[model samples]
Target chain A: MTTIQLPPLPRVAPALTCDPAAISACGADLLAASAQVDDLGTFVAGRARVDDWTGEAATAYHQAIAPTGRRADAMSLALRGVAHRVEEHSAEMQRLLDRRTALEDRQQHLAQQVAHLRAEVATTTEEGAAELQADCDRVAGQVQAYETDLDTWVSDLATEESEMSQAFTRVLGADDVDRIYGGVADPADGPLRDKPGAGASPAEVHAWWAALTAAQRRAVIAAAPGAIGNLDGIPASARHAANTVALGRDLADYAHTEDAGVLTDDERTCYDNALAADEARREIEGRHDPVTGEPIVAQIYIYDPAAFDGDGAVAISAGDLDTADNVAVVVPGFGTDGESAPYQADRAATLYESTRVLDPSATNASLFWIGYDAPDNAPWDEGYDGAGVVTESMAAAGGERLADTIDGLRASREDDPAHLTAIGHSYGSTTTGHGAHDHGLGVDDVVFVGSPGVGGDTDHASDTGVDPDHVWAGSNSRDPIADLGNHGWVHGETVFGAGLGDDPAEDDFGAHRFQAESTTRGGAYSFGDHSKYFDHDTESLANISHIVNGDYDAVQEAEHLHDPFLGPVEDPEYDREPTSPTTSSLTP
Target chain B: MEVVPVSVGEASRAWDEQHLDLDAAATQIADADTSGFTTHVRGAATRFLAQWQRHAEGLGTVSEQRADGLRTTIADYVTSDEATRGDLVALLTYTQEVR
Candidate 1:
């Protein structure tokens, strides 16, 4: 909303020359020339007064000397000579005036030059400030990454220490004697012997199981019914004890007498079925190609129930399209797949829900929930670095897929223009940028949420290959992952402008279309981490809904910059929510 | 002039080595699909040969001597980062196709 106003130019010396130094020098010369003119004028005026008095005295003397013509001639000749002397002084004054005029002109030129230099210096200084700010932003992004890594490491270490402490406690408890102990008296036996005067009596236990060897463990587990089944509630330590006992019993029974033979029809059937099921599941999962083998997770979701109006039941394949009134393709970031927990699904589902919430009357809308080729972890996936490289490639592929989908959709609905919006999160934002670059993925609006950085400059239209008029962004303060991504991960030198100017945390998302705050810090319904950008009812999701529904006024009214790097500030009403969120039926 | 023998991977390493002529070497190797040379690739040819050899062995094509021949020729002339060995395979395919 801020406008810049340039200062007015000041006139000093002559304006002929553009040099500031020359103008300054001209001004100085003019000042001295003017002073000389003033002094000379005063001197000439004084001399004129004295000459008038002398003439009067001479005329009086001639009249008193002789009434004859001889005295008159002498007086007239002397007066003529004085008149000539006055003429000479007049010529000298004219010459001074000419010199002063030339000096004034030079001074004006010098003045103009000085003004120009001042403006240039100011502009250079402003440019330098911008560069410094960019450097600061880059460093901040690095710091954010470092901080996240440190946090993860510390958390890991803490978990390990806690587990170890629990193990030590169990050992100590075993020596109390009140707790049952067997099997070579356990490792703590020696310590117990040193302090035997203390605890309660050991609980009675069958000696046969405690003496089981390591080989017995596997045999016992294999023979046991449902040994690994439905043991979710059993603590790991308890499970280990039960397994150990089972193994010991099995080994003694097998070694002592296995003469009965291996005839159990039910066991064979069960084993075969289990193996077949495992193989089937593996086939369904689809292994990666060995040559270009990279870990990736893929999924497909169908939204439409049936072929309405005799339209094809099949959705268009990649780079093909069937027309629809509204189509949205949501690209998720790293660590996302079909097996993702309810929390992740909820985040992804929010996009569809938010879109519907924005436009209740959009009945023909279809949303493609894409999780194709998403990695299990980041920076480990081959060809994926940041928004600039792998994400960009993903976007390129995704965009092609989207284009195909749109074309197929268009084929079904002849009247629809096939409006598409790409809503990407974190690394997905980079993919969105690459999609824009490919020019095949026609998008009306591009929104990035909880993004570290997109692989393009914030000048989205020109620099990022998207229409600068249709970019949106958001970030949250308590979401440390988003903050880290925004600060340290240079997605593509993207600048955003959605943060609160007062809070340093807000600036991390960069200057962009929109950055919304979570309802609470680290809220489950808000962007919680690197992956959950579209939590249920957060401001970030609201902004995305508004933009996708063609409610630019609503977004602008909210003071979110669509293209922060553009000219002119226009105000329009952007309702906090979409047009009519409840009209569409999403119950199925 | 004959182009220097350097893959992009090698050029990258050479740059790290602080070699003064690395830039020139990079230029030379950038488009060197010249006669009699193994196809210019982005990564090391030697690694590609090893990976393929392992694959071949697993597939029961036990011509160990032929594999060894390919590997030696590669190790002698190719110097590059092992991480991007696939690039070498791609180049070799191009080389065979041209031949």
Candidate 2:
């Protein structure tokens, strides 16, 4: 007989005397009360009622029902997000259990086959018995494989089980379950609300979150998981659990739209972007660091995928960002999304491991933040608006989002705020540069890897608002992309907003230079080469890790002179060049 | 029980190939993978593959922890998500286009 466990259902607040309809009724009652007060005030105003009973404040008093009126909509979003998430968790748990049961059933079937073979072997002739024994041997292995499968299934189930437990009230005593279901009397005192600045600052969110009881917190999560998950200062686990719920709903909607077969082109794009975001979440969760044996701390700090004309923004962390002692956020250059995100995450894991190698005891979280829509990945258009297409304007546009992400991370940080470093690769370096140069993101260090250029007007490391000393750059001497930045710097600022400053690798650029491997083919590195600054065996990767850990002295210096006269070092493996600036209209 | 030595480079390539195939085959599963007993099997398979990917990678960095990790991957793979019952076979048809 197999043990069959049903999926844990959503916690039923037995005392939820307020279903959505009931909540609306309550709001309606409040509205009615307010109107009655208004009527009395009107009578007083007209002097048609009692003396001195002027209803001067009656109309204003009636406005007290506004929050109640708004609560219905807010509660709906919350309930839907929670219910969908609970359903996902339940479905996953049940699946794991069922799969395990299937394996066990297979195991039993094989075991019975082996048993039958053994019985036949006892009764059969020598030749038949030998064949029967061989059958038994094969069947025996199947039984063991099934047994092993079951063992692992149980272990994996624990992870889902634990997540579900947090999502629901698994550890609660019967009395506590009754009380949890009974629910809190006044949700107004709860942490969720749409106040003037409900999530304006991490400190405020922290304070509000701290004031709630466990049950209240659970209730708030159930009602508004997305708001809570997106909220600053909440713990990583809570946010992940909450966001998972929101994501499930979004995915379901996406699936539904697809099923309906009426998705607009825009909706199709949104679906792909949403799918990418979902995959990114999965990446951060079970993956391990390339260097460290520790479980990767995947946190979805921000997941606004449908923002900015279908180019969504997302931030994923490899470790707990809120509590870590050191954090580095990598903004990918171009063509980054759920699909391209694994590469960026791979870079983060590499950097994370390198940091540990640099400082054995450092608690770190490296984030792959594709939090802004970069230039679209496509060939240049008909007219190459040198300034408009793939210009620093894209970075300039993305500056605020980058700033907000850092600000949110900063706000959510625990006591003794983490030493944070922001690094940008390829075009992302410009975005990072501008985020500092323009938006004033507070970071301990800023590193530019394979940068196309900083802004046209911006000169020197200090321009990025990072301490000039902490400004860092790494570009392979043979890297053509870095070379393009050198050309723009050498060409002088061409288009006002489009132009980028001098090459940070140059001695004149004033950035502390680091070595990068230019060994893809010969000594020269091209566009494809530009993408591998964090690849294994590259000195650039080690230097980046050192910078993140604040081990400045350990950072390696560059090799090979970058004089314009240095010319092409050798034939590149994949010598792809950017289109001429005059005719170019590309975004990637 | 039939263990394929999860060589990191090969496994990484496997992951990329699997994703590309899944990207192409998603519609078939997305239509029917929403509910029913099959969904449970799919979810288990999906999660197990996640664990398996992790376990395969762990073989390099933390081979000592192999037993625990491999157990998860093997089980999940048994009930893993597929476009059809022959998802793995279909995946085999797609070659690794790039590294």
**Which lDDT tens digits does candidate 2 get at residues A1-588?**
222211111121111111222222222222222222222222223322122212432223224323322332232222223233445654565566567557656765665665566466556775565455566566656665666676667677656545643432321232332234333233533455532274367666776676778766654554455567666667666676555545544554456546655456776877786787767666665566444565677777666657666666666778877677889999887666444666666677667766765676788888888777676455453222223335676787777678877776776665668999999887788788889988887799999988777666567787888888999988765667776664412544565444455667766567888766544534444566777687755577778888898889988765322445556422221342311111011122
Give the worst 10-residue stretch by lDDT in candidate 1 chain A: A310-319
lDDT of 1 at A429: 61
True-structure RMSD, every candidate: 45.5, 22.9
Candidate 2, B-chain TM:
0.25
Error of 2 at A205 (Å): 3.8
Q: Per-residue lDDT for B6-85 in model 1, tens only? A: 23223222222211111111221222221211122112222322332232122112112222323333343334444245
Q: Whole-model lDDT, candidate 2?
A: 0.55
Worst 10 residues of 2 chain A by lDDT: A578-587
Q: Model-by-model lDDT, in order?
A: 0.35, 0.55
- Assess the local accuracy of residue A386 in candidate 1 as a C-alpha lDDT between 0 and 100: 33
lDDT of 1 by residue, A211-253 (tens): 4443343222222212321122222222333332222222222
Candidate 2: stretches off by over 4 Å: A1-190, A194-199, A231-236, A290-294, A337-339, A379-389, A486-492, A521-525, A559-588, B1-99
Model 1, first chain, TM-score of 0.35
